[model samples]
Target: MKSALGKKKPLELEDNVCRRTNVFKLRGNVPNYLEESGSTAAFQPDGWGYKSHWGMAVNVYSTSITQETMSRHDIIAWVNDILALNYTKVEQLCSGAAYCQFMDMLFPGCISLKKVKFQAKLEHEYIHNFKLLQASFKRMNVDKVIPVEKLVKGRFQDNLDFIQWFKKFFDANYDGKEYDPVEARQGQDALPPPDPGEQIFNLPKKSHHANSPTAGAAKSSPASKPGSTPSRPSSAKKAAPSSSASKSDKDLETQVIQLSEQVHSLKLALEGVEKERDFYFGKLREIELLCQEHGGENNDLVNRLMEVLYASEEHVSSSLIKSMNSPSSRRSTDSPSVSDNFRFV
Candidate 1:
């Protein structure tokens, strides 16, 4: 077994790998060998062999030989028909021929004796081929023939170019845009720049009427024109007969009396209203204090009211009995009820 790692440039000699297995016997579509592009190699009656320019008896798997099953005449005929050359032309056109030339130089005394066979399970067969190639290259010691990194990077770039080309074509067709070879992309244009004064809308401006001095001065005047003459008072006087003057004086006196009476009545009414308001205000304050004393709970007022009602039941009953014993339940016009003093509570 050979190591995938720690082999000096094993990956470079990929073409030199070979494989042979019984499962790939030449019958039906079964392949006996494969070419560089993974196509099956044709078989011939003459058994396959490999020989260097300087001959050496080196045994190799059947897969290593390019003509796995072809007869010598068959190979010669193939070369003559396709390339119009003899065995030399066929050897030249062979996929690994260039690398083999280097290998022959590197291993002057080594050459394949038996051909390597390709199997139906060709993927596994290729792995076997890679192992054989690494072994052969190691035996030949052809370190300078190829560089693995350069080959790998070249293949990677090829795959990337194909992917990018396909992606660009797809994007252009999907988005309905003209394809640009240089950019290899298609999309909408970038957003435009905003207006310079766009931020001014965010702030509120003061009204001109509110800030002007003339507006304030106009408000103070009572419909007067600016810089105009003011009105004057009358100065003429007139006299009347004594009797008529006396009658006018009597009428004025009566009007004054009536006005005085109205003023007195209004004053009394205002005083009564003020007293009533004070009484109710004091009662509301007392109720508030009572509520506070009872831990600020409104239900406590209901309980207190029930207790007062229970305690006053006897007194109310006695008052009812006395009223029944009296001559009248109605109040006389001379002695009014306490409510009559200020009835509008």
Candidate 2:
């Protein structure tokens, strides 16, 4: 379970177990399994970090393997032999996650290599470059190797600067077949003029009409006639009236079209307003019906209250009459009663 690195590590155990499991699974269904995971190193235009590079490397290796007409077993075997590792490590290295991490010196987002199908083809260049990187790591020690952030910053700028320099160098030293500027210019100039039809179409309508030979001939025809000078002014005056009439007709037509469009739009707006009005009216009717129902209930409640008040008044009047007619009341009223009796007699 030990890695090429001398020290024992937890990752080594986990990596080994994963690799073994994957290898056993690969034997069960080679094409199916690989197809399911092969795209792990597939190119992703938006990817950053080691995954992008790993994908590029995989693409390059895929092309080589396709050219060589290698089979899956041949590729796997080649990977194992080149890296001095077992089939499990080879499989893991071909996988998108491990491939990127192994090359980039840091783990990146999970990527599926399923689409790559022949991911093992990437093993050659991957192992070669990885070995070189590992050699540097051994010399520097893992702890002393550049931190991921610093490495990214330093390498990114360095690569950019190198790319710029390379571009400048290539531009300066490039000696491809030189094109003659004079010949190119002459060739362009010698090109046939644009078609007359195209030129006519490109001209303003009025200008095009004025430039027509037929129009010039027609204008000259009357002038060419002998003794036509005296009648020219009259003819022009007549033509002027006709032209003005035609222009007025066009203006009227445009006004009619505009008015018609306005009418149509106004009609649509009126219909919409009517619909809204009807909707509100319907709501108002519902409210009125509700009010009528409530009014009936209120009237019943008022009638009940009035009947109770009338009954209460009648009971009080009867009670007062009875008290007045009682025997004790008659004695208290004896003088007034005797005077009343003498008057009656």
Residue ranges of candidate 1 with Cα displaced over 4 Å: 1-241, 295-341
**Which 10 successive residues of model 1 have the least lDDT summed?**
113-122
The residue-by-residue lDDT of candidate 2 on 156-246, one tens digit each, is 3432332232223222222243433223222222111122123222223344336444455457655446755656777776676567656
Candidate number with greatest lDDT: 1
Clash count of each predicted structure = 12, 10
Lowest lDDT 10-residue stretch of candidate 2? 18-27
User: Which digits, one per residue and each the tens of the lDDT, describe model 1 over residues 157-267?
Assistant: 432332233222222112232323112111222111122223322323555446344455457536757997655531121122334545655775686678678767777
The local lDDT score (0 to 100) that residue 203 gets in candidate 1 is 23
Report the number of the highest-TM-score candidate. 2
Local distance difference test, each candidate: 0.36, 0.34
Alpha-carbon TM-score of each model against the true structure: 0.20, 0.21
Q: Root-mean-square deviation of each candidate, in angstroms? A: 46.8, 38.1
Candidate 2 Cα lDDT to native? 0.34
List runs of model 2 lying over 4 Å from the truth: 1-230, 299-345
